[model samples]
Target: MAEAKAEFEVEFVGACPLWRGFEDQLAVALGAAAALEQKAGAVAVLLGDDERIAALNKSFRGKDGPTNVLSFPGPRVDPGFLGDIALAAETIAEEANSQGKSFEHHAAHLAVHGFLHLLGYDHDEPDKAEVMEARERAILASIGIADPYA
Candidate 1:
């Protein structure tokens, strides 16, 4: 059987690019993740500040603050659609700076993380988290990203 293509879209709000080619880089990351996970469908990504993401976090997740990333499974999933992922620019930047990593690399890792969530991977429990993190490590390794947990 043939493989299914992964389609993605990027939307920017709140803040602008601190890293050049961020959107393109994200596409490459998502594309690679999609291929590795064998996911097929559209996923939307929003790059915004803490405020915008916080609002979304509140609305969808019932959280009170901004998070680094959030993933929502698309309703029409099954035969095609996967879901969407959102990232907070301010939080990502802060995390990258604090972690001594580049903004692009951190953001790319988050993008991969979110994409994996959209594909029905979760870490709600220890066993599940280990499996998910292992998959994450493998996927990120393929993209030359260091193990996030280590």
Candidate 2:
């Protein structure tokens, strides 16, 4: 059988130079999940800096400081217009260094994670977290990445 298809686009603002070819990377991360879910759509990813993400975090999430990744899901039923996902460059770099993973590896994990969130995947509880993480691991693995949780 032929593989399913999904569409995605990347939008970088701020100082995230590492997002040069991120569209393909994100497609890889989203591929298996999209195929399994049988959903076709486009996602807008913003690779921003700490300061920018922090402001968004504070304003939207009512939190202080920057976070690694944030997802603003669009109308769930409208797969054609999935919302946006944002990433913090500084936070991503720092976390990758601390976790002893490459920037690309960590970023792929984040992309999968945020994209999943846009697809209504959440980790607010143990069971849900397990399912989400498993999906993430599987998707990443399919794309030649390792299990991030392990």
Candidate 3:
């Protein structure tokens, strides 16, 4: 039988012109990661600005600021509808510039990070963070992106 591949549906809203071809890049990055290869389903991605993300952060997470990415896991039923991920373009760009990493690489990392969350991965604790970060490093490396935590 053929392997199952996850599908990504991306929507752009509010100052996300800089991410014109990001959906393709994200698909490549996610494919390299192999996180969703065994599951046939869909993941929704939103590319928005700081203002939109900030509102979401505050409403959903009780935080009052914009973040790079946010993940919302789905019910995990048949056909595996994984979840949703949102990215803040401005914050990602700023973080990329500050970290000396290419914007594409950084954005890919964040996208992967959000995807992992939908797979029930979390980094709230040190041990969990270690595991999550390790997976992230390997995934990023598979796509020629350096260790994001390094």
- Best candidate (score: lDDT): 3
By summed lDDT, the worst window of 10 consecutive residues in model 3 runs over 5-14
Q: What is the C-alpha lDDT of each candidate?
A: 0.80, 0.80, 0.81
TM-score of each: 0.85, 0.86, 0.86
Error of 1 at 37 (Å): 0.7
Q: What is candidate 1's lDDT per residue for 1-150, written digit by digit as tens?
A: 996555544443334455346887788788778878876666777777788889999998899999999998888535465776788888999999999988888898899889888878889999988988898888878888888878
lDDT of 2 by residue, 1-150 (tens): 996455544444545675666656665666565665666777777888888889999999999999999999988587587788898888998999999998888988997799889888999999999999998888888778888877
Off by over 4 Å in 1: 1-15, 18-20
Each candidate's clash count: 0, 0, 0
Question: Model 1: number of clashes?
Answer: 0
Strongest candidate by TM-score: 3
RMSD of each: 2.8, 2.6, 2.6
Better of 1 and 3 by lDDT: 3
Model 1 score (lDDT):
0.80
**With candidate 3 superimposed using the best TM-score fit, by how many Å does residue 54's alpha carbon deviate from the native?**
0.5
Model 3, runs deviating above 4 Å: 1-15, 35-37, 76-79
Please report, as a residue range, the 10-residue window in candidate 2 with the lowest summed lDDT.
4-13
Residue 26 lDDT, candidate 1, scale 0-100: 84
TM-score of 3: 0.86
Candidate 3 residue pairs in clash (backbone atoms < 3 Å): none
